[model samples]
Target: MMAAQVPGFYMKNESRRVKIPFIDSNSLVIIPVSVNGSEPINFLFDTGVKSNIFFSKTIADELGMQYTRKLNLVGADGQTVLSASVSPNNHFDLGEIEGIYQAALVLDEDFLELEKVIGIPIYGVVGHEFFKSNPVKIDYDNAEVTIYRSSALKWKPFGFRSMPMELIGNKPYVNTTIRQIEGPEIPAKLLIDTGANHGLLLNRETTDEIVLPPLTLETDLGRSLGGDLFGLVGRVRRVEMQGLKFRGVITSYPDQTEFSDVIIETGRQGSIGAELLNRIKIIFDYPRERVLLKKGAKFSEQFDYDMSGLMIRVLSAENKRFYVSQVRENSPASLQGVQLYDEIVAINKVPAYFWELADITNLFRSEEGRVITLEILRGTGTEEEAPEKLRISFVLKKQL
Candidate 1:
């Protein structure tokens, strides 16, 4: 059952839990949230951010939020500059808990690029401060998230592996060991980030465990709040955690030259995100300095990647639309005439508007030799000129 909307405050009923189902998009936890009683929209449950961040100023305007001040923030180590406005106050609901955040920051960027990469609508991101006074439990297998009051909760692990975490400026860090095939395990520190959807990102600046496997693919990993975090994707022979071992784990390494050092200075070797975490059910107990993990159904599942060499994002101005923002060179998409800025108006003869970005993206990840039919609209439609619409078909091929 969806969480029932409640008013005011209620005393803690430790036994009572509000369960909110979540979508695992690119290892990022996307949850439905209603801000200021508005219609439910997708929000990234992120612990990496310092405060609650609304992706667009239009969101603040639509909510009738009054601005407190304006500030300039550097993101991704000066890769992209953010112009942000502070909202005086805001109320949002995550599961059954209602949170009131003060001085919420809304960015000028629409973050449609981010949605394109993740293939979902991410209206905003709620960070540490949003739940600083509360506790959250995340069950990856069941896709349920529970939020509890900090004072009314008592946590006891039942057969779950518990790891002691160190909180530095609101982020959790833990130590783990990673190894290449037949190599000795190398100890490394990783930040537990629920916001990231990718499995493992080893900072070449910090650790030397990021060795590209025999087979690797050059792809645009994902965009950061600062800018593009591009890198190569491959697999490591094994990764050891607490007393468990994950073999042949897919890993990614961001080109230090293209990324910023802000992540490295987090004082960890690298970061662990949803992809790996999804293998286990996790509880992020911030107030208690502990993270509980239990193996989940996905623990043994192999990690598959986007077979089509295309990066798509959405446009929400008039209606929701998906477009090809980037295409890999010499890949199946580029070989089949897919181009930058090509509007994906339809798929399999169905109107593109009929499908969500997630659906369109999933089609791109089909097994090799799978054929996909897409309707493409090229050029802009004008009063005298109409955009060229072309029907294109391509077979999905694994690049790696």
Candidate 2:
């Protein structure tokens, strides 16, 4: 059922919408947007957030936005909370879509700086408030997002399964089943968070019925408003959705203590993020209380992760070098003597300066058992003085 009217945004034709190009960086959707005629900025097109948020205080202050007061925000991660100021009257444009946000939060810290970890610029985030007015389509295959007025949506497409969703605090939650190897199917409620990068994230408590895979590895999932999210990564034997069974799906379970009280109150098992949603065409129909899904080309592709046991980050774009942000103990990279803060000058003889962070990360995920030769520079003293360069070879092996 369509609401009487969606506030905030209006369409010129009401029947046609335009597709905006987006960068799918490290599984996060970064869309270009502008606020109050400011230069275009990248905002995370996150379905998990409730309100529009500008993460940079500098940006907020420069805009001359008035703040009502400060409030503490608890995140879905359950562990992190942010103290932010509530500002009103924010007008933003996303291609042909434009809207006025009566109130938006601005964090004191440049949460957008987190984008640097992935080598991108994400100034803010647009969430439920932006989508509430119209139907939105995310075509991951073509890396484009399309906005449709309620009238333009067909509502139902062939070969798609529709499931009712419960809107909790402006985020969508769905009840689904995850099959265990020996026990009955585990019924769980999960959030549809395009902002999250993982395929499946279950609170540690939800895995009692479903046994954990034989192989699991300690990994740093990502950052949350609270802190860095660290967890054990593994695979679920099967996840059945709409009569379709996805086997050997990669999954993560964060510590129970990390989640906030509100998340626990909602009894949310975990979240289904872009990693899984990208395998299927998904429609988030909040007003109708339903979500639709159709299989995508990558539906059958194997779930993969970085096999090098090394988490790398771009240290300097001008220098074209990457620094080891983290090294998993006992992993291939660890076994090969890769250490934290080690600069990567080249990979397999190709200068690291010539490769983008995404491509370099992909190279590390190449076929398991493949040999990767990394040229490393140790130490962080004066850069003018040449540092020691060492060649270390490691075989790409699955950690979990």
Candidate 3:
């Protein structure tokens, strides 16, 4: 059930637990969030979140919030969303916790929902932005999460470090660092985005906010996780998690702004994206209010990438349905004229069947420069005089 909206303070009920959904972190209870100088307000514990977001506009207009100008948002999907600023005070009377917080006003928005009732019109989404350095622990069985300040334990299996990020209207925002493909690093306090598929998404207009070096790479457009935003793709100079930094050659993009549900206006300027993937073992701790990225066992061959511009899916001939989705651009599949929506009828003279997408791509990405034959049922020809089981041979390429 969704969390029931509670206005006044209530003692923690030992008998029942509430469930709420958050990105970076998935689901947790709605415990009271106490500010330095205000009443203890309710907050949903979310691990899916990479930062914090408090909608100042909703608070001011609906809840009578005080002060500020336009706000900006840095989202994890690698987009910069700017907004008019506002004071976080009117959003909630967090008493003593009212510090100089950056925020944006918001209307009804969503990130993810693991709730059905016990609903809440979120004033803000709080996440890892609260703590950066170490890993925070969440005891869902016990209904609590712990963050260690100063002294940290040494027994961590994955030494992942997460950085605190700020969000506006639910998306993360930050200054930015867009590294040129060659030479020097362009300083950008970009977003810590997980909601994006590729690494870095940059725009000359927004990325130029921070002084950067000359860019040498060509970029293009990319799709957002929610398909809500189009982002510029290019490489980042460096992506840092806590003090552990990874540098050099990465891909990013440019142009077009992003509008996300999870990335709210809470003062941050940029969102973090794919630059942090596979490179580190991610302990995306939402309950701990931090995203811990650990250096995990790296396979030397794992990073060896070759694209065969074919997004393929496995299907059961009998079921007449697909079970895979692997699309690579500029690949043999593209050269051989394999359309995206093609229905596969056979594989190597046999009626092919697959249970998962992984199974298809495993066969597709494999055998580079090797000839593979496929049989397809391309739509219809009259009634159903046996849908043609095509046999076409093609070679796979290493570039996409």
User: Best-fitting candidate, measured by lDDT?
Assistant: 2
Give the per-residue lDDT digits (tens) of candidate 2, residues 176-206.
8887544567888898899887888877564
Point out the worst 10-residue segment of candidate 1 by lDDT: 1-10
| Per-residue lDDT of 382 in model 1 | 90
Q: Estimated TM-score per prediction?
A: 0.86, 0.91, 0.49
lDDT of 1 by residue, 39-125 (tens): 888888887777778887877799777787898877663555688898867777654556554457888876435666676667888
| After superposition, candidate 2 runs with Cα above 4 Å error | 1-7, 74-81, 181-184, 258-260, 316-321, 383-386
RMSD of each: 4.3, 2.9, 11.6
Output the number of the TM-score-best candidate. Answer: 2
- The Cα error of candidate 3 at residue 50, in Å, is 10
lDDT of each: 0.73, 0.77, 0.41
What TM-score does candidate 1 get on C-alpha atoms? Answer: 0.86
Candidate scoring better on TM-score of 1 and 2: 2
